[model samples]
Structure formats: C-alpha cells, structure tokens
Target: MSYSNNAVKVFTVDPLNWQPWVETVDVKALTPAQIDVLSEAPGGLEKIGPYYALLAHDPEVLRERTRLFNAVMYGRGGLPRRERELASVAGSRVNGCTYCASVHGRIYNDLTKRTDVIQRIFTEGVDAQLEPRERAVVDFSVALTRSPERVTADDLQPLRDAGLSEAEILDLIHVVAMFAWANRLLQTLGHPTRDEVVLV
Candidate 1:
C-alpha cells in the first residue's frame, strides 16, 4: 500500500489524525487505563513517546530493554555512526518500509553529504553505487535481514576484509537485525513516516 502525504503528517503532529479507510490503533491517544494494559503487555509501549505513560505500570523491565538497545546502538558497538545508519537504511529499504527508508536515508545523506548515494540506494538497490566497505555493509545487512539461514563465514569475510572488526561486524548485524524487527512492527502497525523532520 502506498503512503498518503497526510500519513506522514500524523506522525509529525502530537495528536494523530486517524485515516478513514485505514483501521489502525492510535497508540498516542490511549487513556490512562489503556496505557496500564499496554505496559503490562510483552512489548512495553514505553519505548515510543506516545506510549511513555505505560512506564508507570512497569518501569524496570522497559527501562532495562531500552538501555540495552541504546547501548547496542550507541555505546559498545564499534560500528561507526554513519555505517550503522547505512545498515539501517539498507534493511528498511529491503523490507519495503518507506517511512524507515526516508528516515535513515536523510540520516545517511546528512552524515556523508552524499545525496547521490542515498538516491541510488533508495531508487536503485543497496548495491547500486557504493564503495567496497559500504557495499559490504549493505550486502551483509540485506543477507541478514532477508535470509539469515543462508549467512555463513564467507558472507562475513568481506566485511572483515573491509576493515571492520568482529565486534563491529556483529554490531552492524545487530543494527540491521533490530531495524528488520522495527520495520516489520512499524509497517504492521501502520506507523507513518516523518521524513521532513530534519533529525540531524
């Protein structure tokens, strides 16, 4: 399904405008009691801003998961910030998540100042016009996201050859994997993209 121009606008605004044809759950507008129920559920709603109220019900577990995800993305992971963003964009592209593709494409463009590269990755494929290292990262991300069962030592060797350490390679894999999960969730839940919001 194609995204409407206003679909993204919903995420840009505080109060979401639910579409008439789209039957979606508005996590942002839940009542206090509804928030409590979400907090008690498996995927704590607290990670997303609209669901923050759920923290009142179960702060500890939600906090721990958020912390670990943050650490993996920003702390101990040796993968460079730009590379991580590239991996995220690549995975989101393969998953057909326009929202995530736009978000991470903007990030990659801002950091690398390579709009051409971003355009190619989005319009063409991840393997379109990347350097060896960038190509390795994109290839690895696509492989891990699309067909993890097919991944082997040979699949990882190129990333190693591209100068990424084992830890950094694993970090890249984690970022790709996480985004795969995130892309599915956001797409399934009909989360809209706010690409015009300059995150940089």
Candidate 2:
C-alpha cells in the first residue's frame, strides 16, 4: 500500500481484515527545533527516539505519556518475552492495529521460533491455531480489548486453567489494557512507526 510522503510504511496487511484508524507518521520531515525539544523531554529521546521529533506540535505531556507507557509495556513485565509478545500481538490484532500486530508478530516469531503460529494468527483469527497457554492468552487479550466491561470471573478462568499465576494474569491484563490505550493514542496522535525515524 502506498502512503503519503510524510507517512511511514511498516506492515502491509489486508485492510478488510484488520482496519487501522490512522496512517503511520514520517519522521524524516521533522525540523531541527522539533528534534531539540524531543531530545530534552524525559524518556522521550529513548522511548521513541527520532519519532518524537516528528510530533513537534504534540504537547510534551502526551509525548512523555506514550514514552512511559511503551517503556512499561515492553520493559517491566516479568512474564516471558514470548508470552508478553503473544499477548501484545493478540491485543493488537483485536484492537485492529495492523502496525502493532505486524511489529509484535515479528517479535513473537523471533522469540518463539514459531513463525507458522504467528502467520496463522495474523492471516486467520487468533483461535485458528494456538497451544493451550497461547490460546488462553489470546482469548484473554481479545476479551479485554473488545469488551472489557464484559470481562468477569469467567474470563479469568481460562488463564487460570492454563496455569498462569496471578501475577502473570495481572500482567497480561495490564499489557492488554495499556496497549488498548496506547493504540488509541497512537491512532489519535498519528504516531510514527519505527521505519519513519531518521537516525541522527
């Protein structure tokens, strides 16, 4: 799919399957003043790097919030990286963030060496093919993303049955919830993809 000159192209997916709300931003167009402002912001230089430079008009608070959110989601989780990526992928899939799904899908495949499963979830539905634990994580993520209000004790059962500890389950929920917010924020603010950044 062709994007605007200022847009970053990350993943090419069937728009009919996963519909993302916003096109990716192109960081190459950022001005020096924007870069200077972003570089000085807390965690801004690292969490988003040059991408934050593209969002020159964005409030500093929003930039810092996104940076902090990503840091926690990708960094502090005690769960296995594979498991965390699974939940992230599943949540992105449910949230219809094609960019996030593709990025996390690659990470999941790399970590688990399970490209087949990753492809299956991306092409088909998450329920199409997954192990017991994987299925539980996918289900929980989907439920949490789609209709969080509908989540009840029954929703946690599968995760519990899959032998996930309370901490893991909580972590899964937090990741899903955080990503849900992050996806919307990125969509609303038109966050740039990694491809958009121009390394200095």
Candidate 3:
C-alpha cells in the first residue's frame, strides 16, 4: 500500500505497520553489507520490513541507527525496560507518531500488564491521568519532545521527585530524545498503513 501519514488514525494503540513512500531495497538483491546490517537488526533478517528495507539503501547509516536504537532501548540496567518503553510511548504520542506509539505501547503493556495506561494515553492523549510515576515520565517525555531547547535541569526535577536516579533519568532523556528523531523519521519517510492493523 502507498504511504501517507494522514492515513493512520490517531489514538490507535493496536500494533501497526508502515509503508514506505520510496522504493525499498529488494531482499534478494541486497548487498552483503546490507544483509549484514539487517541480520543484526532487532528482529534479524527474517523480520526486516519495508522500513528496514528502505533504510538498507544506506547500510552504514542503518547499521549505526539500529545499533543506537538497540543499545538505548534494549541495553541492560540503566533504566527499567518498562520505563524506557513508557518514555518511548510518551514521546511517540506527543509527536503524533501513532505507529511508534502502538509498537512501544504493546511492549509497555506486556511488561506492566497495565493495558489501562496505554488505553488512557491513546484515548486521552499525553495529558491523560496517570499514576504519579507514570505521570512524571509522560510529562517529561512530552516536554522534551515538544521543545528540547526549552528544557532545563529544572525540568528534570519531576522525574527525580518521582524517585528516578540520575542514571535512570539520563536513560529517560536518551530514550525520549531518540524517539523525537525516530518519530520524525517515520513520519517523514513514510506512514502507518491502514490495510493491516495487526492486533498482536
């Protein structure tokens, strides 16, 4: 299907798929380097999709991007995995990146069993009511995503008060900041497709 950002409705927490605006590299025609990059990507070669295929056009860039994303979101011990996912969801929501939000929201739900939180976010938005810690996380993510330059150390106080340590707070910043770039890339390069809304 053709890609268009406007095609995917907002507030959809269901798992979604992307469609690239430009032609994607054919898996069969991939160079050895491109194949190597996809092999190391999150889901590996078997899982590479249109987004990965499109990025495969520049194997070096895609390799670095994939590594950075994996390190930040899937690396060990800085921020709790759930919190990292939460920051991602919050940032995606604020940026209106419905596909990103949906993907990460599913992960958050799996981690926390709090489908209610994702439900509230999708239905009510970034300002939706949340438990204190979640509220702090979502608030900070929103502020950073909305305007990074305006954020100050003071802006970090809420997260600190919510009991996050310096390391966790730093991790939060990294995740949210990464999403700001990720969301934009997803929106600018393609959009969520409506044809297949996988509920998994």
Candidate 4:
C-alpha cells in the first residue's frame, strides 16, 4: 500500500461521503518533511487516508503519533487483537466519534466473525449490554473516555478480574486513551455524511 505523493491509490470497496472538518494537507504537494512522516506511516501514505493526511500538516508530531498508533494497535502481544479493537471501538463510541467507532467495529466483526455485540454498540452505545469480557473492556474504556481524571487503581480491577494481565491492562488503556484523543481530534477535524461521495 506504499505510495508517493505523486501517485496515490488504494483499492476501496466504497467511497466515503464526507470531508474533513478542517482542510487536509494536500498529499499531492507534500513538503519534504511531511513526505518523511508519511514514509514512516505503517503502510505508507496510501494507507493513511484523510485523517493522517490532515495530521501530516505537522510532520514531526504526525511521525511520533503514527509510530505510537502502529505500536499500540498493530504491534503484537499482550491483549488479544479483538480486545484491542474493542477498546478502540469502545473509546470511539463513548467519545461519540461515529466514523472511528464504525471503522473499528467493522474490523472487530471481521476479526471475531461476530457482529452481534458490535451491532448492539452501534445501535446503542459503549454502554450497551455485552458479554462479560466485552463488558469489562467497554466499561473500562467508557470510564476513561468520560472521566479520565477520576480513574484510580480501583478502576482497573474489572480488567484484572476479566483475566487481563498487567501488560494487557496497559495495552487496553493505551488503546482506549489513544482513541479517546483521536476521536476528539476527528470529531473536530472531520465528520461523516451520506450526502456526498468522496473518491480517494
């Protein structure tokens, strides 16, 4: 999925229907610094889509941000992949970032081969009833998203009780926290709509 600013393309199953809340960096005219950041992106520029393109307006920050994103969500170990994706979706849903939530939900469904829980979440929320394990993760994520400062050691007991190790707990927190930050950023900088077609 690597691509240069001059020739960018990704095979998409469907086109997005909205644009960024703020203008995105012009990938076709990326500066050298921005190009470097895009290169460090996990799958290169083509995989970044509009969100990272917009973030790339500040290359130094985007580079570090992308590195952390790739490591926390895509890197192996600790939490199961589905749980990590659940954390992402939960945080996004709690933060009311429908676009991010939906994207993660689709990935979660694909990975778990089940859409029941995700459907409940999409139709209801992070608070929608879930399996005990899924509920634990979502509860932790929702708590963090709604009130991070109030979180305490006691707040972690559920995840611990749910069979998550300390490392897994750390990964879950990272996933939720990252999405909490990113969800707000996207809410402010981008939006979803079925009103128009945007062919990337």
Q: How close to the true structure is residue 176 of candidate 3, measured as C-alpha lDDT?
A: 92
Model 2 misplaced stretches (Cα beyond 4 Å): 1-37, 40-51, 54-56, 189-200
Residue pairs clashing in model 1 are none
Which tens-of-lDDT digit does each residue in 121-143 have in candidate 1?
86677669888999999999999
lDDT of 2 by residue, 67-181 (tens): 6666656666466668878888788777666666776777777787768877787778767678898899899889989998899999999988989989888778878877887
Q: How close is candidate 1 to the true structure, as a TM-score?
A: 0.69
Off by over 4 Å in 3: 1-6, 196-200
Question: Counting only residues 3 or more apart in sequence or on different chains, how many pairs clash (N, Cα, C under 3 Å) in candidate 3?
Answer: 0
User: What C-alpha lDDT values do all the predictions have?
Assistant: 0.67, 0.65, 0.86, 0.75
lDDT of 3 at 57: 92
In model 1, the Cα lDDT at residue 197 comes to 21
lDDT of 3 at 74: 86
Which portions of model 4 show Cα errors greater than 4 Å? 1-18, 46-48, 195-200
Q: Candidates ranked by TM-score, best first? A: 3, 4, 2, 1
Better of 3 and 4 by lDDT: 3
What lDDT would candidate 4 get against the real structure?
0.75
Pairs clashing within candidate 4? 21-189, 21-190
All candidates: TM-score: 0.69, 0.69, 0.92, 0.84
User: Candidate 4 residues 1-200, lDDT tens each?
Assistant: 11122121221112233355566778788999998998887568676566777888889988888788878998788899999998888787766666776677888888989878888877766678888888999998889888989999998898888898999999998998889777777677656544442433
Cα lDDT for residue 85, model 4? 91
**Superposition error at 84 for model 3 (Å):** 0.7
